[model samples]
Target: MNTQEHAVGQVHRDDISSRMGMWLFLFTELMLFGGMFFLYSVYRFTNAEAFHIAAKELNTLIGCFNTAILLTSSLTMALSITALQKDKKKLSIFFQLLTIILAFGFLVNKYFEWATKFDHGIYPGSDTLLAMESGEILFFGLYYVMTGLHGLHVVIGAALIAVMTRLTAKGIINKDSFVKLESAGLYWHLVDIIWIFLFPLFYLIA
Candidate 1:
């Protein structure tokens, strides 16, 4: 409850328990994404045309760029945790900052891409929604729902990183640091992994 009273794998925000809890939470997130993927399969089977058309509308190059960016950030995050474990505070903070910057870039690029789509009359609902036939409309419907949820996770992951940055800067995390940096890493990896697949599905399903 105090961010340090973890037990049985609740992720006391630090320690083995925290890592276990992080894995547990990640498993649940996996299941959630799994269900979405299932939905995607169903709809793609039903609306192959719309799905293909919508997929083409996405900017594949940009998606690939972001994928690389996230993968790099994941590397930095892992290095940060390793540095923390080795009692390398300064290096840990440096990697953490790098990871943060990369994450921000990923989100900014996403914002611009999505904004451009909206400008071109494509969004969850409204004119674009009206323009789409039933199956096409349904295609964008799933697109919005899935990507919107993933975006929410991005925001949440950024918030977590901000918190970790603060805690690390304040010297709250140590070799024995009771911070959930690893769990943070776990969540970060999950975010990256989700995007990896989503990029292909949403942008390059040819």
Candidate 2:
């Protein structure tokens, strides 16, 4: 085989390696959250009434709105991938920017939700929360910890997408090497998926 052919083969292998590494990282993430979910489920089962009461305090409207936003962001993330694949650099960048905006919107909504909770004196270890039933306190504690972790993931995903957007603009991440963009999309989708479960569990389960 020619040297050029060998070089192409090597690049293809490198791409495969990069994708595999990302998938492995995602698997580890899933495992981490899976354990949390298991604990949440057990607690919910044991404290059914208190959990329901606690969940009722959450704003379902806001949760649903954020759900919609994240779903749309997932769509835009997919569109970004497709645009890059089609060699439409401008469209790809546009979609990436939209995804970032939607992510920020989600965070803004989250801030308001948490603020409302705090205003009601419902935060973890708050006097009001401490006065509540043990089960309700447990529910809120899990709620805060789980959602806070998910929010952190959202922030990280947004930052990664921002970097990807810059790379795309600079011609560093184009049709041939848009794998970084794809990785960011995958991570964003993972974040969205976690929120999907969280919305129903924390907002609608009541």
Q: Which candidate should be chosen as best, given TM-score against the real structure?
A: 2
The C-alpha lDDT values of all candidates are 0.84, 0.92
Tens-place lDDT digits, model 1, residues 1-206: 44664357754343566677888899999999899999889988998987887777778888889899999999999999999989898899999889989989988988888898889888876786687777677777777788888888987887898799789888877688644787788899999999888988888885
**Pairs that clash in candidate 2:** none
- Which parts of model 1 are misplaced by more than 4 Å? 1-14
Backbone clashes in model 1, listed as residue pairs = 11-18, 13-179, 13-180, 174-177
Q: Report the lDDT tens digits of candidate 2 across residue range 101-161.
A: 9999999999999999999999987999999999999999999999999999999999999
Per-candidate TM-scores read 0.88, 0.94
